[model samples]
Target: MSPVRRRALVVTLPFALAWAVVLAVFTGLRDRLPDPLATHFGPGGEADGFTGPGAFLSVASAVLIGSGLLIALGVLRTRTALRAQRPVVAIGYGTAGLLGYAFASVLFANADAVRASRVSEPVWQLGVAFGVACATGALGWLIAGRDTAPEDDPEGSAAPARLPLADGEVATWTRTVGSPVLLFGGVVAVLVGAVLAAVGPGVQAWLIVIGLISAAPARCRVTVDRRGLTVAPWFAPWPRKRIPLARIERATSGAANALSLGGWGYRITGRGSALVFRSGDALFLRLATGREFAVTVDDAATAAALLNALIERERGTSEQRG
Candidate 1:
């Protein structure tokens, strides 16, 4: 294994082992806990539903342990040797860390409830769990580093040459792509919300929020201009991504299959990050830093051509400055 891969294994396995130990400890102490421990809380922090200690332990352990094991397997089975697979390893370890912290939060909350004989506010417990998980994830990122590489600019890197732009000249192209995945997600969320509404308003409210968020990426805009490339969802602009023309190394048009990219909607895969909407032509961007990004949108060929022209102009300007 490469040094990077070894480091990833080291960073990931500890969290898995730690969570395993925690599960064992919790199981040993289950007798002291209440029968049917309160697991879910309402909006006002009251207990919503209860599950037996055995059931809760089994379900939580299965999910957390299962995720950790799957990550380890993927890392071990990856075909590339020199390639670090840093994002995969980091995300895997980070998710395990989050699950570990969440499991601890549940344990502590239930421990307190068992002592008091009542379910108190789980909001604080879960909030703290989230904070800790983020910190743990950040630590994993630090260990793995940025995981970016420079693209090898072999011949035929750029899209077929377009009319070369004059120095300081500007051009732009814009298009919108609708996401079927987002639509499907919204539908599923709505259906789940309706089903959960039969239980209680508080539980259903969570699903409603999920549905709204799921619909946010229903349509996204792609803009390529002198400034750079921008990908922003129609529902919000603050979360947009901008790639300055200077950073882009190459541009090409090709198919954007979600299956190859490992699902869709703001995906991070073996290639890099992408705002994937559909399984069709996309403008593929290779940055100077070696990172890759793709935007699946209509009229990708024009976008790629215009982008390449701008990049060439930017390179000429930079060379003159040097």
Candidate 2:
């Protein structure tokens, strides 16, 4: 089976089915449930917080569906080594089991409660949830079996993008790139926080903080010179990431989506690591360790070409010495 479809089947189906069953049971007990369901528990297990049934259902759906899609799509998009794919598949099943057990436990605890405050949960049930999660995760791992690793570029190596450079010639290319989507999301979050302030000041405060952080665009200066590639934040250049020319197998340019690269910021995925801040043109580096590193930026083609030329020059100098 194709790896993408295999991962989708192994993860998505179980996750969807688990949530579907939980929702179904919750609906079946609607008549028995109070208008406001007990959503939180005290130390002694008495209910401490409440939420409207409709609102609770809405939040549940959003969490389940949103997270499930992200997981499924993430697995499908990136190519993975067999070793990395194993844990990803297992975690997928375990997550579904954990979420399903927790949600269903709440419904059963709140069943037929005269008042939200009177609801109680046997804390032991939390242990059961973990047990169930472990079993399901193990099953997923077993089902994953042994899959072959993904294939790389043909011709035994990537054909590096090149720009002609003469002896002693030096070139440096730099660009500052930022994510508009992050800015948009931050604005929306702040607006939502304002609305939530009426309900709970404590929660609204955190939401506002998160919105501010998200809204602030992150800019990085991408530089390619004889020293290879360097990425430094616009705010501070002291802390920067660099890829040495000796470790780079090849450099190329391609269009990369932020989500497919595992969202904004430095993230590790089954395929490789990425410095994702936006979704657009990106410089792709295949390293000697068989892992790829990518940086999203404008004018990536120029940067990639410069890197290829520099790497070739370094190789020629090394060959003559040998």
Candidate 3:
């Protein structure tokens, strides 16, 4: 194992120990907890749900253990597989810490409540908890730092050669892609609404909003013209992306994977952001700000080549003017 990986593991050790301590403390105090613990609290800081102490502890333990193991496994796998795993490991450890602290605080608070025979207001300061976790993770990542440079994608050279255009020529291309994310999100929202309805009627109003978002058309129109690249859903006018030619540093065509982009649908990955609809070749852009952006669409090779040509042409025009 590399020295960096060793450091990462060491940095995460304290958090794991913290989890263990919290679990042990809560278990020792289990006998002191009330018969039916106030498991859920409402907005007004009142008990809304009750569960046996055993069930609560069981669920908490399972979530904590499962999540911690998954994150640790992720760090190990990513460290072995990718050159840059600092961000991934850091975020994972930080999130684990955040969850551990949150659960521990909850358990302790409820125990106190049971002993005192009084309702427990939510004592966890979500902002502070999250902030501390994120800070710790960021620190670990900074300490671990970048281990190696990212390897070149073997298939990146497969992009089509830049198209040739005349000095005054203006080119345009158009393609449409289906966005299944809305459909999927819509289905999930409807299911959630059904579950919420069973719990209470107050959540019914949010169902309408979810329904509208889901029912919207799933087609996105992608256009590349003299005005640069424009991507917008066919059904919406205001929500669109217009990347001007000047801001684009480079364009390439490559296969996109949901796992790499962390589950797709306008995802923000460590490298940059992606607007992915399906897994296939996509037009990737390196912006002047050194950020990467991508959009998955059909015939990405042609788009990438044309985009390169256009960028060169724009720069050429400016050079001639000077």
Which of candidates 2 and 3 is the stronger one according to TM-score? 2
The estimated TM-scores of all candidates read 0.57, 0.71, 0.66
Lowest lDDT 10-residue stretch of candidate 1 = 149-158
List, residue by residue over 1-322, the lDDT tens digit for candidate 3: 6753664465456457657866786787787677677655556556655677778767776766665664454344332323344555566558767777766666666774644335565544666678869887876576546545343351364654588888778789889988676576767677767776677534555875775565453578888887778888786765788899999887888776443444435667667777777666688888899988888888888888888899988898889899
Distance from true position, residue 33, model 2, in Å? Answer: 1.7
Please state the error at residue 211 of candidate 3 in Å. 12
* Candidate 1 per-residue C-alpha lDDT over 180-264 given as tens digits, one digit per residue, 9 for 90 to 100: 7778878788887887777654567677688867777878888999889998887678678899988888788765444334345
Candidate closer to the true structure by lDDT (higher is better), 1 or 2: 2
lDDT of 2 at 8: 64
Q: Tell me the deviation in Å of residue 56 in model 2.
A: 1.3
Which sections of candidate 1 miss by over 4 Å?
A: 2-15, 66-95, 111-117, 121-123, 146-160, 163-201, 204-207, 215-250, 253-274, 277-282, 285-293, 296-322
**Each candidate's lDDT (Cα)?**
0.68, 0.76, 0.67
Off by over 4 Å in 3: 1-26, 42-44, 54-88, 112-117, 122-128, 143-146, 149-160, 164-221, 256-280, 288-291, 312-322
> How many angstroms is residue 38 displaced in model 2 relative to the true structure, after the best TM-score fit?
1.3
> Order of candidates by TM-score, top first?
2, 3, 1
